[model samples]
Target: MKKLLAALVCSLPLVSALAVDVYDRDPDHTFAFFEFNHLGFSTQRERFDKVDATVTLDLENQVGSVEVSIDVRSISTGSSMFNQILLSDTFFDVEKFPVVTFKSTKLNFGKLDDVVSVEGELTIKGITHPLTLTVTQFKCAMHPMLRKSACGLNATGKLRRSEFNLGRFAPLISDQITLLVSMEALKR
Candidate 1:
C-alpha cells in the first residue's frame, strides 16, 4: 500500500502537467492589419476592429493550429469617407459578406528556431484559397496583467484581391495585399 501511494503521488504531477491547456485567444492582444498599394504610388493601410480566433497547441508534438474570423464591417482606414467606400460594393461589400475567416490545416514546426510555417484556407467574399503564412517568433508565457498563460505569434502573407473576386478597383487599388497578423492566446 505504501509503494502504491508513493507511485500515485509521483504520477500526479506528470498527469497535471500533461493536462495544461495551451493556445488561448486573448481578444485584447490580437490584431490583424493589412497594407496595399494605392494609385500605383502610395501604400494604404487598414485594420479590423473586431477579431476572434481559436487556437490549439500540442506541446508533445510541438504543433499548433488556429482559426480566425474578422468582421468585414469593422474595417477602419482612418477616414470616414474611405471607410464607407470600402464597405460598399467596390471593396469588402460588408452588406453581403459580413465576415472573413482563415482556417489553418497544417503547422510545420521549425527544428532549430521558434518560427513555424502555417498553411491554411482563407475564405473571403465567399471564395476560399490556400495560403501559406510564415510565422515568426511564436512564444508562450504567463501574462502579468491578465494573470493567465498567454501565447503569441506573428505571421505574414500576401493575397491577391482579384482572386477573391474583389476586383472592382483593379489598377486603382493594387491586387496584392500584404497581411500582418499578431495574435495572443490565453489559456482557458
Candidate 2:
C-alpha cells in the first residue's frame, strides 16, 4: 500500500503537466473588427468594443478550443448614425440578438505548436454558419509586463453578409465582409 501511494504521488506532477491550460481573454487587448468595400470607393472598417472569450490549450496533445462572444450593441463605426443603423434590425438586430458568438469545432496546429487555422461556427443575428479562420500571426510566451504565460493571435476570415440576413445594401455596400480578430489571452 505504501509503494502504491508513493507511485501515485510521484506521478502527480506528470499528470498535471499533461493537463490542459485555460486562458481568459484580456478585454483590453482583444478585439473583433470587420471591413467591407463601400460602393467600390473604399473599405469601411469597424470594430466591436465589447468582447469576451475563453481558450483552452493542450500543448501536449496539440489541441485547443476557443469560444468568443461579442456584444452586437457595442459596434463602433465612428459615426453614431452608422452605429445605430448597424444595431438596427436591418443589420445586427441587437434587440433580438444582442450577442454574436464563435465556437471552435477544430483547431489545426503546426509543427511548432502554433495554430494554423481554426474551424468553427460563427453565429450572427441568430444565424449560425461554419467559418474557418486562418491564423496569420500567433505567439505564446511569457508576457513582459503581465509576467504570466499569454498568447496573442491575429486571425481573419471572410463571410458574406447576405448569408446572415444582413444584406440590406448588397452590391453597393458589399456583401462580402472580412472578419478580423486580434486577441490576447492570459493563463488562468
Candidate 3:
C-alpha cells in the first residue's frame, strides 16, 4: 500500500502537466491583416481591430487548435468613408452579418522544423468554406513579463472574396485576398 501510494503521487504531476487549457485571445499580441490588389496598380491593405479567439495547444504532439472570430464593422482601411462603404450592403454588410469566424478541425505537423498546417472552416457572409492555413512558426513558453504560459503562431492563407458572396468590386479589386494571421494566446 505504501509503494502504491508513492507511485501514484509521483505520477500525478505528470498527468496534470500534460493537459493544456485553451487560452483566451490576447488582443495586444494578436493581429489580423489582409491585402488585395488595387486595379492591378498597388496592393491595398486593411486590418480588423476587434478579434476574439479560443485556442488549445498540444506542444508534445506538435498539434494545436484554434477558433477565431472577427467583427466585420471594425475593419480599418485608413479611410473612414471607404471603411463604411465596405461595411455596407455590397461588401461585408456588417449590420446583417456581424461576425466572421474560423474554426480548426485538424492540425498536421509537417516534417520541416516548427512548421504546421491547419485545416478549418471559415464562415463569412453566411457562407462556410474549408480553408487551410500554412503555419510558419509556433512557440510556447513562459512569458517573462506576464509570468504565465503563452503561445504564438503565424499563418498565411488566401481566399477568393467572391466565394463568400463578397463580389462587389470584382475587376477593380482583385478577387483573391491574402490573409495574414498572427496571434499570441495566454493560458486561462
Candidate 4:
C-alpha cells in the first residue's frame, strides 16, 4: 500500500506537466502571408492584416487543435491598385465573402518538439478544401517582457488558386500560391 501511494504521489507532477494550455493569438505578431508567381516574373507577395486564432495544445497527448480566421477585406498587396484588384470579384470578392477560415482536424508530429503537420479545412470564397500546414519551428516559453507563457509557430503550405475559384489569370499567371505564416499566442 505504501509503494502504491508513493507512485501515485509522483504521478501528480506528470499530470500537471501534461496539462493542456489554451492560447489566444497575438494579432501584433501573427501574420498570414503568401507569395505567388506573377506572369512568369518576380513572385508577388501579399498578406492579410487581420487574423485571429485559438490554439489548444495538449502536451501530454502530443497533439493540438487550432482555428484560424482571416479577414478577406484586410488583404494587403504592395500596390493599392493590386490590393483593390484582389478585393474585386476577380479574386477574393470581399464584398460577398468577407472572411476565410481554417479549422484543424489533426496534428501529426514529426518530432514532439520540432515539427508538426497540421491537417485542416480551408474555406475561401465559399469553397472548402483540405489543406495541410507543416509547422517547422514551434516553441512555448515565457515572454521576457510580459512574463506570460507564449508560444510561436512558423508554418508553410501551398494551395492552388484555381481550387478556390480565384483563377483569373490562370494559364498566364501561376496557379500555385505559397502560404507563409508566423503566429504568436499568449496563454489564455
Top model number, lDDT: 2
Each prediction's total of clashing residue pairs, residues at least 3 apart in sequence or on different chains, is: 2, 0, 0, 0
Residue 25 of model 3, lDDT score: 77
- Candidates 2 and 3: which is better by lDDT? 2
What's the CA RMSD for each of the models? 4.0, 2.5, 3.2, 3.4
Model 1: per-residue lDDT, tens digit, 104-130?
A: 998778775354878999999899999
Clash number for candidate 1: 2
Q: Could you tell me the TM-score of candidate 4? A: 0.89
Rank by TM-score, descending? 2, 4, 3, 1
Instruction: Give stretches of model 2 more than 4 Å off.
Output: 1-18
- Local accuracy of candidate 3 as per-residue lDDT tens digits, 1-188: 99999999999878866775678878987878889999999998899988898888665556667899999888989999999999998889899999999999888876543548789999998999999988878777898899998878899999999999997778799999998898888998
Q: How far off is residue 42 in model 4, in Å? A: 0.4
Instruction: Work out the TM-score per prediction.
Output: 0.85, 0.92, 0.87, 0.89
- Would you list the rank order by lDDT, best first? 2, 4, 3, 1
Which candidate number would show the highest TM-score if scored against the true structure? 2
Model 2 residue pairs with clashes: none
Clashing pairs in 3: none
**For model 2, how does the per-residue alpha-carbon lDDT over 1-188 read when each residue is reduced to its tens digit?**
99999999999888966688899999999999999999999999999999999999987788899999999888999999999999988788899999999999999999899998999999998899999999999888999998999998999999999999999878899999999999999999
lDDT (C-alpha) at residue 45 in model 3: 86
- lDDT tens per residue, model 4, 7-113: 99999878866688899999999999989888888898899989999998876667789999999888888788999999999899999999999999997766555
Worst 10 residues of 2 by lDDT: 12-21
Error of 3 at 95 (Å): 0.7
